[model samples]
Target: MYATLPSPLGTLYIAASDDAILEVDFRDEAMPPCPPASPLLQAACDQLDAYFHGERQRFDLPLAPRGTPFQQEVWQALQSIPCGEHRSYRDIAALIGNPKAMRAVGMANGRNPVAIIIPCHRVIGAGGKLVGYAGGLERKVWLLQHEAGMADH
Candidate 1:
């Protein structure tokens, strides 16, 4: 099941499996915190808070995002993107041995079920403009700035 969570910045979508997290989405809704142990739901909420506060880099929680093999490969590559730098979809496509799969890379990027922790916002357009965030361009911009330490928050 999925639940929306509250944070300093905005609401977060958290989905969990019996073993781990499935997805995390940021949305414009008001919510309260959930317990952070026992139930996977609350634990996901806590991990997400750590991520947004910049206190956590790598995630230890389990994730079971449903996708095609190519999409999973793309998502894995996104996880390897260092905290502050950015990679283009083209760059990821090349790294994954699918140099011609730029759009496919983008498709995978958009389908990333776990949001911020996976760092999909770290991917940019070929020309360096921001593009392709499932969480809306504004939140994408916010995440980039937050990671860059430029967000006014």
Candidate 2:
């Protein structure tokens, strides 16, 4: 099941299974056909709204993103990055116990299905430079800035 929510960045398409969230995407194209509303999806959207409003820092929704083991490890590490803070691909690689997998970590970050909730935007390139984001670099910048602003409060 799935639902769409308007966000500061853009339209957010949230998908979920019966029990856990599967994906949250920012697509400019037409939204795919959606099934009936799922409570899980609605909750995910609600959490995202709180996040964009800076009222929420940590996401408490259940997520079931599908990916390889390495990707799973990378995504889990991403969630550990505190809000308003950032990490590099290299840092994520090391967190996952594979310091040599920086490039692979980047690839996995790009493939992250559950965008904001997974906190993929918190990952950056080396030297604190912004890098690849499936949701566009501009949105990535906005998310980071939004988090920083929230942290100041």
Candidate 3:
């Protein structure tokens, strides 16, 4: 149900249900217990590796991130943000048909269980400023720039 793998950003802890991904935590927190390798975990690891290497711009794994309905809505909106593009919390709130829920949207974004696959790093502050990310601001910047193909800049 879980596995850890090295990435350009850092060690990544990947968790999954029997057929869907559940979480992808950075090394900042206590590592989750590792379970025996499963097909889903291996697929996640492969997709993640391709993403970091710039060979993948989208993920195809089944994901079942546990969260409130609102949070799930926010995560779904995040997926709509095309790779290499960024949006503001306000934009996401509006996209989800709740234009007044910018703050709530931010909170939901913060709690995203799946990381890169859900693409929460694509959300930014009001004026395109890098802001809160569970994976850390630096990693956020790296991810955004990586998607933009400007990682060498």
* Candidate 1, residue 88: how far the Cα is off, in Å: 0.3
Please tell me which model should have the higher TM-score, number 1 or number 3.
Answer: 3
Error of 3 at 128 (Å): 1.2
lDDT of 2 by residue, 78-117 (tens): 9999999999998998898999999999999999999899
For residues 84-135, could you state the per-residue lDDT of candidate 3 as single tens digits?
Answer: 8999999999999999999999999999999999999999999888899999
**Every candidate's lDDT:** 0.81, 0.89, 0.89
* Local accuracy of candidate 1 as per-residue lDDT tens digits, 1-153: 677777655777787767878878776755565444447887777777787777766677777788999998999899889876799999999999999999999999998989887889999997998986888888888777777773232
Off by over 4 Å in 2: 30-36
Candidate 1 vs 2: which has more lDDT: 2
Give, for candidate 3, the lowest lDDT window spanning 10 residues: 27-36
Q: Which pairs clash in model 3?
A: none
lDDT of 3 at 100: 95
User: Which runs of model 3 end up more than 4 angstroms from their true locations?
Assistant: 29-36, 150-153
In angstroms, give how far residue 88 of model 2 lies from its true place. Answer: 0.9
